[model samples]
Target: PKEDRERRGVTDGLLRLSVGIEDCDDLIADLRQAIERSARR
Candidate 1:
């Protein structure tokens, strides 16, 4: 399962987001917050 997941671009350093049916500004703000949160770690 791990090998198959990696072959399909599901790596540790990869962030894949599938957002749908959400407001544009809200998504942008959420992304900015996530980036800020991760940077603090």
Candidate 2:
């Protein structure tokens, strides 16, 4: 499965997100914060 996914251009850095009923600005801020936090690691 990993080989197939790689062949199809899917990799470890891929992020699949599903937005719920939250406000767009809230979601964006949350995502930005998460990315920034991860980057610090």
Candidate 3:
């Protein structure tokens, strides 16, 4: 299962989030913060 997941290009840092009823500005801010945090590592 792990190998299959890896083969599909899903790495350890992958994040699967739910965007349920969130506003655009809020989502954008969240995404920017997430990307920034990932870039730091």
Candidate 4:
């Protein structure tokens, strides 16, 4: 399965998040922070 996923372009750094019933602004802020943090790395 790991090989298959990698073959399909799903590598180890792929992020899969499930959004629940949370505030849109909060989600946006969290996502922005996460993206910024990852970009810095």
Candidate 5:
């Protein structure tokens, strides 16, 4: 597990989210948060 979870240094900022029956505003907020966090890296 450690070997498989090691960082590959590929900062693609890929966001995979599932908006299943949730509010659109909430989904956008989540994506915004993810992008903001990634940008801080």
Candidate 6:
């Protein structure tokens, strides 16, 4: 994953999750999907 574009609170090896009070299920699903996508290649 790439570093966040907005760098105010970002660190060198940070993995930021921009969840604005969204549903926990959705957030977890999205993370799982992303992890699978990243692991595929």
lDDT of 4 by residue, 1-41 (tens): 99999999999999889999999999999999998999999
Give lDDT: candidate 3, residue 31.
95
Candidate 2 vs candidate 6: the TM-score winner is: 2
Across residues 1-41, which tens digit of lDDT does each residue of candidate 6 receive?
33453355566666866778889999899999999999999
**How well does each candidate superpose onto the true structure, as a TM-score?**
0.69, 0.70, 0.57, 0.65, 0.55, 0.60
* Ranking according to TM-score, highest score first: 2, 1, 4, 6, 3, 5
lDDT of 1: 0.93
Could you give me the TM-score of model 4 versus the true structure? 0.65
Give the Cα lDDT of each candidate: 0.93, 0.94, 0.91, 0.96, 0.72, 0.78
| Pairwise TM-score winner, candidates 2 and 3 | 2
Query: Residue 30 lDDT in model 4?
Result: 99
Off by over 4 Å in 4: 3-13
What would you estimate as the lDDT of candidate 3?
0.91
Model 3, which residues run further than 4 Å from truth? 2-15
Error of 5 at 2 (Å): 22
TM-score leader: 2
Give residue 4's lDDT in candidate 2 (0 to 100): 94
| Candidate 4: residue pairs that collide | none
For residues 1-41, could you state the per-residue lDDT of candidate 3 as single tens digits?
A: 88998999888879788898989999999999988998999
> Which residue pairs collide, candidate 6?
none
lDDT of 3 at 24: 94
